[model samples]
Target: MKQIHHILILPDRVVVDDQPVTITTQGADIVTELYRRYMNDYPKFFKMDLLSRLGLVAADILLQTEGAERGAERDDRAVVIVNRHASLNNDRAYEATIQPDNYFPSPSLFVYTLPNVVAGEIAIRNHYLGETACYIAAQEDVEPLIASTFNEHTTSVIGGWLDVTDEKEFIAKLSIWTH
Candidate 1:
């Protein structure tokens, strides 16, 4: 993980070159809804409703757009970081799933339980075909998260947090690093 090409900060609703990309909520938010939006927008590319499927779906999209930034080439080594704490707001589901004895949860909510779903989404969307990992924290902690994932051949990293509570507030910073 030597090359961090560019770090993009998408705060709230932002238009990147006239394209609409917004972080509307935070904390226990319905991440699936966001997934649906992506599906709707890129119908030709993505068609998924489950978290696992969404992970791969997102990864495919990432490979094409963000992955192309470096040299119009694809690097499966690229990593992605999803800020789960800030983006998840479904406290009810969180509590139910985390119950001591409740191992089997509503399959829908269970998929989002792991923080790495974000990376999964990106990998699925882009078909990155790289090592994928996820981290969970109350706040943003980039050092350890990035360090652990960084490798000598790593070209760049798509890292950030997404939160969706009552309203919706999240930030995903896709940074491109180089050594």
Candidate 2:
């Protein structure tokens, strides 16, 4: 049976190994606080969109320290993330960019309107050049993507429930499954 090696829950909290992280800080600085509390260095984190930011933070918490040293090969790990809003946060922002008043879509903001960008961001951060994909499911849908059951080629999978309704309303519950 596949086992869950680690897990992370966010924007307002961090839970690992089924226990609440007591060392965390809170409020509007949740991500920033968690980044400084758990990560040693990852300056590029600030550049990501809200969705990507949440995904990256969850991935880091799952792959930090001893978990990273496992040295999984480049193609051994796959990233499969699922979200409900499908970058609605970025979508709204992108729409604002192209409005009549603005008349010009911002490239950086336009680029992340796709939901898969969150998965891509995770793959880049963890150096996992394997199968990377994202699924758009309704809040009630349940499809399996976070396991070695993916296909014969993949040995492990990194993914889970990743959703962002907006900056203030979001949750990223991620985990790694090793088969």
Candidate 3:
């Protein structure tokens, strides 16, 4: 089942360096609706953590349609590719945390050190228990990452880039591919 595809794209949004992203009213409303639909298991969805909030939004976009929830079994798979340009130095802060001389890592920003955390958030929201990975690149290398996934023969991949800086630009695209 080797194939190439382009998933959904959530345009005009941006993710922050070390904080929860600010979304448009349309984006927020979409997330809220999806949470009400697929997240019935969770009684108090609004009070969920920021991590959960981000994940739900990703899941909502990835799993579009009403019955999409039915396909969101534990066997489904997903991957997240965040854009480096989303922020001025979001990755730089992650690096500084581990630097010996400059221990300037902010605790708030440290939580996002694991790129997969966002993936996990989406996984939890949609109950996708297959496989996931997170990568860091400046830009123009997204194809390499996509090709590597093909080499691994992973199907139904959901990949995109989320960048948050002064401009707040987000490019989250979910591509369901198979090999």
Candidate 4:
């Protein structure tokens, strides 16, 4: 049977295994706070889009709480992420850079225009080399899409709904599922 460990991150709080772990300050950015608290060693985190940052932080909490390996390649692990917006926040930023008056397209923002980049960021951070996929679907349809990524070679998975909007509203309900 597959055992799943869960973590949910919101702008106001963070929960792990159904218990509240952190109550974020009212105006502070939860992603930045989480990065400062858990990912100070990883400087690259500062450059990622909000979606990637949210996903990575959620995965970090889930994996750390579950005592999973970090900083080592793990071929048995996979990453799957689902969202409704599909990187629209970064896409808007990237679009702004290419506007007619200010035609300076940022390569950094451009890379994050795809939702799959969130999954890639999570995989790269944890050295998970198995399948990495992102799906754009309604919240109700997320389960089957995530389940489809599992296979015989995959022993564990980090996946769930990760969505962010231009106004910085976000939610990351991530899980670590182990066989």
Candidate 5:
């Protein structure tokens, strides 16, 4: 069994240790709002998809609350997350770019169709430089993701659920755990 410290990132809020941190402001899009309000300093965040943004915000708060430094060089950590929609929102956006109206398929949008891109983003942001993955499952499950850590040289794991169906639909439950 894994002893874990967790955080929940909802559509319009960010919660750590069962306490909402008031991370978002009054806006139509919470992801954008949260990014602007809490993590606007990271320029790369503007280029990411909605799912990645949610994951980033959640991880940002979770790491901060857990006293983990993002810039610190650490390769012993791993990111293991599960999601439901799994980049479908970006897929739909990419699909629209190739339509008859404007037949220019955007490479930027095309690159984000992969669900693991969010994991990669999180890894890059935090400098984990270790095992990182995003599992596409029917529902949120920690077993497979957590189990992967056991096989790797991972000393700690950032594991959880990150699901984004569209702009307005998403949820992330993340945890920081040590083995």
Candidate 6:
């Protein structure tokens, strides 16, 4: 049987296993604060989109709290993420760059237009070589989407809802499931 461990990363607080790990009232600063407090060593974080930043931060918190291995390749661990917005935030930014007046599409922003990029970013950061999947679905379908991703080769999974809107509002509810 697989046991699921959960973490909720909100604009004001982060909770793991139903216990608040950190609290702050600042809205947008929570993401950067999480990066600074938990992952200051990864300079690449600054280059990622807001969606990826939220997912990465939530994954880091969930995996660290669960005592999952880090700095090591884990072929048996999979990363699966589902969201309703589907990278709309980055898409809007990229769309703005391609406008007639702006005509300067940013390659950096273009890279994150795909929703799966968030899952890819997390895999690269953690050295997880197992399956990485991202799906765009309704909130109620997220659990099924994540469950369907598991296979015989998968021993553990880091996955959940990672959604960000064009307005910069976001929510990440990640979990680590292990047998």
lDDT on C-alpha atoms for all candidate structures: 0.47, 0.74, 0.51, 0.82, 0.78, 0.83
lDDT of 4 by residue, 58-177 (tens): 888787888745687878888988888999988988999999999999999999999999889888888888899888889987677766767788867889888886544788888877
Cα lDDT of model 2 by residue, 1-179, tens digit = 35465566665677776878864555336767777777648787777788888788778877762255834548777887887888898899889878887888889888898999988888777777889888887534423546434667788787778888876778877767776
Q: What residue pairs are clashing in model 3?
A: 7-174, 13-170, 15-164, 81-160, 83-161, 86-163, 86-164
Candidate 5: regions farther than 4 A off: 23-28
Model 5, residue 113: what's the lDDT? 94
Model 1 TM-score, 2 decimals:
0.53
lDDT of 1 at 17: 25
- What are the per-residue Cα lDDT tens digits for candidate 1 across 1-179? 44333323232333322355565643323234454544445452233223333333334334344545533335546555555463244445656776778755667565565656656666555566767766666445765566566676665565544333333344444444344
Best candidate per lDDT, number? 6
lDDT for model 2: 0.74
User: What does candidate 3 score on TM?
Assistant: 0.54
For each of the candidates, the C-alpha root-mean-square deviation to the true structure, in angstroms, is 6.4, 2.5, 7.7, 1.6, 2.1, 1.5
Candidate 6 error regions (>4 Å) = 1-3
User: What's each prediction's clash count?
Assistant: 52, 0, 7, 0, 0, 0
**Candidate 3 per-residue lDDT over residues 56-90, each given as its tens digit:** 45555445532244543665455656565432334
Q: Candidates sorted by lDDT, descending order?
A: 6, 4, 5, 2, 3, 1
How accurate locally is residue 149 in candidate 4, as Cα lDDT from 0 to 100? 66
Error of 1 at 114 (Å): 1.6
